[model samples]
Target: KTTTAALIEITTTTATTTKTTTTTTITTTTTTTTATTTTTTTTTTTTTTSTSTTKAPIFNVNMLNNGDAETGPCETDSNVMNPPGWTCNGEITQLAYNNTFIYSRVNTIPGTAPGGCLFYGQISGYTSMWQTIDLTNYADPSLIDTGTVEFNLSAWLGGFINQNDRAGVSVTFLNQANQTTGSVTNIGPVTDTDRGSVTSFLFRQATGFVPVGARSATVLVYIIRAAGNVNDGYVDNVNIFMYQ
Candidate 1:
């Protein structure tokens, strides 16, 4: 953030005047033939002035991955799991191998089976899976900066039958007092790939319907598997930035 100041000026002016007179003593001695006259004038003036100016404050916050333990998530339960102004809900586990976090939604939604909306990983030639996490813990509509909420996200989806499966992130706005202000969702599907690797996804707050009196907000990223077969996705490098 940055700030600057300016100067102003003012000016004024004024004027004034005076008067005088003459007597008739000679007219008294000369009786009938004498006369007298008198006259006066005056002027006054003044001036005044003043000056003033104004300035603004700057604020910024960056949630990015830079390999720093304090700024990146490398393992489950890592000290950097949830930084300031953020929280996690549900069964979200951070993986140490690639510094990625996985959320499972299995069994949480009705009709969903063993790994309904969850992520599964290889376990000794077998497989391990868990349920999805709720975004409410990460985003509070009331805390979002109504003017600047942008998400620079990326993920990877390994070979699976559900290639058309949808997955994405969501953001909620909150007021300065930390109350729910509004909510919006960003949805998309992962592109099918033979080998798993990082893929990019970007989500920003919509132009219209921004929250009122909101100073900040929360963002939640999810790898959704739109109802279908048991398809799992890998996610990484989720970046959050706020404009000044």
Candidate 2:
């Protein structure tokens, strides 16, 4: 009967379990770095200059002072003989020619002679007067050194009637040491024969190149007595000129 008693029906059920796995992935990161450089430049500059000077050459000028003999204490018979521009030796005087004793003695002064006065030799024998002109005053040293200067020496030289007494002029170029640099240049000692035995003057002139190294020039007026007690060497309008 009932002994079936509760053989209870034990129903054993087996369940299958499904497992889900969560995987965490860690990724390693690697980084690479680089560097760069820059450069600069500069520049500079400069300048310079120079200067010089030059002089002009001289032309057409008379280098002698008082060449006309007009500045004088003019007299026929003067004791203190002083012609304004010359250093004199022996007896020398200035004679008034326009209306004085000299005009009567000379008979005629040249028309070219300046009307004021004349140079006279008052004593017998050798008589001389001179003047030194500084050439640098008229021309540049380069002009004189290179012989670019031309000289014109001129005078009216004369003597008394039929006498051997005579007058002459000369120019001597000198160095800085006062030594002669070249041959002397002379104008005239117009003789009584050349003057036709008349008491009058005759014109004379000379032209030439200036000597080298000539810093100064000396003008000499001289007289020689041949037949008279008084020196009859007469000169008028003596001149020295320079030109390029």
Candidate 3:
């Protein structure tokens, strides 16, 4: 059976009522049914979603921009700005297909995030990258209960062997005026791989949640070198997953 009707979309006002009606026909039968109007009292909610095929299992959407830093190639020193979602202070690092930087996730990881590249901090210095997301639309400034969001921010960090070489990501909560909301350093200070006082190429993950009453948030990725910058660490797969 085929049913035909003009499509009508309506967004009802709060403390309002919505009613819908339907008519069915089989040429031999006719039936008309009217749906009872639904009265909705005061209610408020905000939902934001971004699509992706490869995502962490916990969330149905990902809000990070070019979250894996593979939006394009991080070639040559002059073109470090290739990672689309962030303003970076570090170098863009890439993986050559000559058989290296390979792991289980690199083979099985999903989406637009390519597995062969990362961000790298310079040796003998500090490197930082940042991105911000506005949550003001999702929050009610006067109500703390309505102004909160929960999410996990993550980044994959690695570097050539050494004890002082370290990389980590931090998330800071901000108020609507771009002011700090008394929350910073969601997760951080992740160190590098070391063996008998010598640092080697290795990577790991660091992640944490954003605090409540945050009208916005800023994410930062940083690398620190205890010694020289040779074989300095690399970062990739930076991501954030909102609570479902």
Candidate with top lDDT is 2
Local distance difference test, per candidate? 0.35, 0.80, 0.55
Question: What would the per-residue lDDT of candidate 3 be over residues 55-143, giving only the tens digit for each residue?
Answer: 22234245667667567655433233435567877553443222233332233322323455556554427767788866443333333
Top candidate on TM-score is 2
TM-score comparison, 1 vs 3, better candidate: 3
lDDT against true structure, model 1: 0.35
Report the C-alpha lDDT of model 2 over 46-158, residue by residue, as the tens digit.
55565533356556666777767788567754443657888988777777765344567754555455466777887748888899999878777777889868889998888
Give TM-scores for every candidate, taking all chains together and pairing residue i with residue i. Answer: 0.36, 0.74, 0.55
Deviation (Å) of 222 in candidate 1: 2.1
Cα shift from native, residue 119, model 3 (Å): 1.2
Give RMSD to native, each candidate: 32.9, 8.3, 35.5
lDDT of 1 at 234: 34
Per-candidate total of colliding backbone pairs: 29, 0, 9
Write out the backbone clash pairs for model 3.
123-229, 124-229, 160-200, 160-201, 161-199, 161-200, 161-201, 162-199, 162-200
Arranged by TM-score with the best first, the candidates are: 2, 3, 1
